[model samples]
Target: MPETRSYTLDIESLDLDGQGIAHHDGKVVFVDGALTGERVVARVTRRKPSYDKAQAETILRASAQRTTPPCPHFGVCGGCAMQHLDVAAQMAVKQRALEDALAHLGKVRPDQILPAMQGPAWGYRHRARLSVRLVPKKGGVLVGFRERRSSYVADIRECRVLPPHVSALLLPLRGLVGGLSRPDRIPQIEVAVGDQATALCLRHLEPLTDADLRRLRDFGEQHRVVWWLQPKGPETAHPLDPAQVDALAYALPAYGLRMHYRPADFTQVNPFINQALIARALTLLAVRPEDRVADLFCGLGNFSLPLATQARRVVGIEGSETLVARAREDAARQGLADRTEFTKLNLFEVDAEWLRGLGYFDRMLIDPPREGAFAVAQALAALAPAERPRRVVYVSCNPATLARDAGYLHHVGGWVLKAAGAVNMFPHTAHVESIAVFEPSATAA
Candidate 1:
């Protein structure tokens, strides 16, 4: 076996991917499992001309922020990083990640930094997809997260981060899989929670035997969680019991809203942060009774509903017809049908004329996926400096794209970045969810 080369370096900061930064002989090295202000010995994993990748071999000094992770699968499971750090430390790392992206990539920063959004650390996940693997040598199946740095599934019977009910189903699901003829071949389990009930979708490689179906049905009746069997892709997912006893939904009590979604629909796992995000986004919009607001890429009217509370009318545009229909239903359910309108459109390719055809809207609230709204943002950037929206609230999942779009809005759109902040949507991971507010230039009107 080749000996692993070791180097001692002082950790400077953390990168967006949860890697630790260290300057070794003036070359910037990023070491995994290292923290800021900690001196450690690292074994180089991959070497590059300008930098290198390493794993912390020895933490000669550890930060006070470091904590003993609760899960036994901490290091071995590839599901989460930052588990070894305190929640406060996790928030700090995320904040720095946002700041680094803004400074290094965007070359611009918000005039004010809003407080970081934080939430419950454990059992907060409303949705999850657990991997399923049958390891006959150990037991019947290894079901849970992937193993660290490997595709192999981590044998996790209990997960502290998932909602207690969902976590409790892991072992039973594993046992149930064992009863299946092709237990190992049966792939993953997806858990999605709605307001009234929880739904579990199990992906199977082959049709279930009659006896296997009975066991699954019995488990479903006992657990109160609807079981969905997926023989093919997500579209093939159907209830193990077609009685329609359970429905998947999530609620925004503040807005008197409850949304139903299929198991595969996009919903925030951390419900608390999402509620706060909706509240903050609407607040930033500062919607008035007479204001007309446009919710670009709106799904299920999460932001649109809240905006309707303040604005005179809210026009929500989404890429999927299903989501638009769902949003319309939600609007009717909330008695905001007259105030909120839903439209299905490709947000990526929209323009001023297209938007004008829909309606005249002065305020814009956008929440784009990880790809970000390159085209939508570019159009916003091209809006005449004198005719731009008075306020725009942008929510994003990817910081790089947010920064890229921010650069265009700040340098091109003649908008002032009022405030920006980070939200801890995915705890213990490097993913940063954030919102930014941009106001038109003072003299634009």
Candidate 2:
């Protein structure tokens, strides 16, 4: 191989992936393991016409925001990208990302920037999907997240992002898998840590023998965890023995609510941050006691039930039938069934006419997936002043989509972007969760 070229570069900014950006001979270079305002020696790993990818070899000047990563597998594990940066700095980067997306992609800016919502950085991940691989060369069974960019699993003995009790099971889990009847048949382990108990869903391609079941039982007994086996899809996942495990649920004590979820369901990964986000979203929504509210793209009644506690009526619209059913059940369980209604609808395909059918809502809360709520935004924009909700609180996972939708709501729909801010849901990752509030423009006809 030809000698690799090395460049001394000054890191200028951070990309969405938390990589450092530097200019090299008029081309953009993305440097891994480097921070903004730092001068580093980087080795060109891949070159492109417009941009290049590099790995930082040495830091000539360290940034004040830089801090030692708490996790030993920080650089190697793709599970987290911003672990090396201080928690405050991580929030700053995410805030910048949200602002940039809103200004550049959405062409709208919030009138006020809400203070960043924060929670515990370490041991905050309540849910995670760990990759399992039987690599004889590496050892026996290697279990952890995939390597930074490779498909290979990182040999992680402990994960700082996981709760201490769950993290302690990593090595034992490796042994458990390695001794299974068909070690190679297992692909991944889905971890869901609830308030009362920890559950692990093992995805195995082949059947487990009686011996394998006994071993799993013994592991669960020893570790005080519940074992769920998934032979096929997520729907097929069930506890090995239902009597041995407590139902998986997380408590939102402030609301006196316990939200039940399955291992495969899409609940917020950080329970603490999720509680904070819900409170912030609701406060931004400013629901009134007599108001009829709409929770669009609501999952598992995460927000709807809380809204129902205050609002006279709450209608939740979701694309997933399963989630809708679960949300409805949760509403009934919470005694909010009389106030809340959930319906299955692909919010992505909705238009103005369809939104009108739901009647007028005094306030609306939107918590969309990464795709954001473009169709719903358009529908809301197209509604007449009398038909539109006076205020909207949009909770978004993708800042770009939120910005785009916010821009349309402001520039096209005659709405005002009231306030926006980042929520540090995944503190050690580049994932930006944001909440933006909107209201009809004062001058709109």
Best by TM-score: 2
Q: In model 1, where do residues sit more than 4 Å from their true spots?
A: 1-3, 243-246, 443-445
Q: Could you list the CA RMSD of all candidates, in the order they appear?
A: 2.1, 1.4
lDDT of 2: 0.90
Report model 2's TM-score to 2 decimal places: 0.97
- Candidate 2, residues 64-162, lDDT tens digits: the string is 999989888888889899877889989999999999999999999899999999999999999999999999998899888999989999999999998
The worst-scoring run of ten residues by lDDT in candidate 2 lies at 1-10
lDDT of 1 at 363: 91
Off by over 4 Å in 2: 1-3, 244-246
CA displacement after TM-score superposition, residue 248 of candidate 1 (Å): 1.9
- Which pairs clash in model 2? none
TM-score of predicted model 1?
0.94
